[model samples]
Target: MERTLHLRLTCGLLASAARLTPVPFLDDFLGDRARRLMVDKTLSAHGRRFPSKQVAPLYADPHGCLYGCLLSAVKLLLFPVKKVLTWLFALRYLTRDLSDAVLLGRALDGWLEAGRLADATDPPARLQEASLLRSAFDNAVAGTDMQLLQGLLMKALRGVSGLPKAAWHAVRRLRRGGAGADPTEGLSQADDDAMKRGTAKLGAALETPEARAFLEAFDARLAENVRILEARHASG
Candidate 1:
């Protein structure tokens, strides 16, 4: 998932949020697509299975993996702020293509997770920074956020209290229908199929010589970024 991220850097600074680690143990909140939505496929039905063979090539050829980017972006956004920033910094800084803009769409949920963006001393600048961050995120990933939103709505419905009998029945129906299969997602079969094709194609494309060269470059860039991060964050 990290390898195939559709990275776009909005600015040049110590940006971060999405982390590179295993998902926290989510309860049954995740459905059958648990594995897929676990990493960076919240709304995507593609199940974000980055088989070891397919990882390098997809990173090498970003063009062949827009769906992968979207999946990665969407999945990354669903996490808490720290993890999201980690993922963003990694993708935005490590990729060879610095000209391409990386969307911080995941940060739009800053309101949901206050302090995700560090607050300035002055209230005005703090508000302005948060607003800008949200607007940027809205521009990039709002379309995909709908699926995440729907899943959230389902969770909300399930969490609803003191609802009327009719409303409770409606919520029950929704759960029994599509929500039961994958509680954390609402992607249709078509969306799932598209992800399948995208994942397979990118995986296959990475096998080429061109992709191998790109992978070599990417590795160097990633190592360089890690060194920079260590230098900046390490204890004095």
Candidate 2:
């Protein structure tokens, strides 16, 4: 669990860095890669090697994809004046992407554990799970206090300019080790402080009632499927 937390925090920090990209869709592309990496690492930690063919389908969220397209279109339209407007939108992006790492990480971890308990062998099961999880998550976050989350994360990360460097180092270490590396290691004093604070802030947000219900709801969904599978196994 500690290792998984580290992975999520590291990936969240990496996603936050996408705000630095001057090109809009480029940041989205980079953020998507970070998410895929998170999914792969999370599943690997659960002792399941994710099939390359399933990666795309497992991460597909129809609403998120549509949002991404609309976001990219807006960015393109404002490209000429991004220097003035980027900062305005950066906070929202950071809030969404960072929280996504935490939320998605937790959801994937729980779902995979349920799959294991049920002896689920088919890869397609993951796609079905992903669809339900994504829909549920989207609804859950609709009531979240975006402004508060943005403020907490932004304040924590504001003065620590070396954060990007720390994130980069963590990414390099993860790639080198492939798994089990702490994503928050080797940071300078300021970077470390910011990371700790930022992480705590994220935790606080996720501990909210809405967030708690989301996890519980997903858990119930998984438990039902597990029971069904267990019954099938027993019958066979």
Q: Which candidate is the best by lDDT?
A: 2
Query: Which residue window of length 10 is worst by lDDT in model 1?
Result: 9-18
What's the lDDT for all of these models?
Answer: 0.31, 0.60
Task: Count the clashes in each prediction.
Answer: 19, 0
Candidate 1 lDDT (Cα, 0 to 1): 0.31
Question: On residues 1-236, what C-alpha lDDT tens digit does candidate 1 reach at each position?
Answer: 32232111111010111113336312112211122222122212232222312222211222335764566656556656745564565533223111111222122222224442233225454434434433333333322323322222223223223222222232233235542232213444453343344334334444456544544444344335434544654554
Error of 1 at 89 (Å): 23
Off-target runs (Cα >4 Å) in candidate 1 are 1-186
Model 2: residues with Cα > 4 Å off, grouped in runs: 52-75, 81-84, 116-120, 146-161, 168-236
Model 2, span 30-50: residue lDDT tens: 555566668778777778765
Every model's TM-score: 0.26, 0.61
Best by TM-score: 2
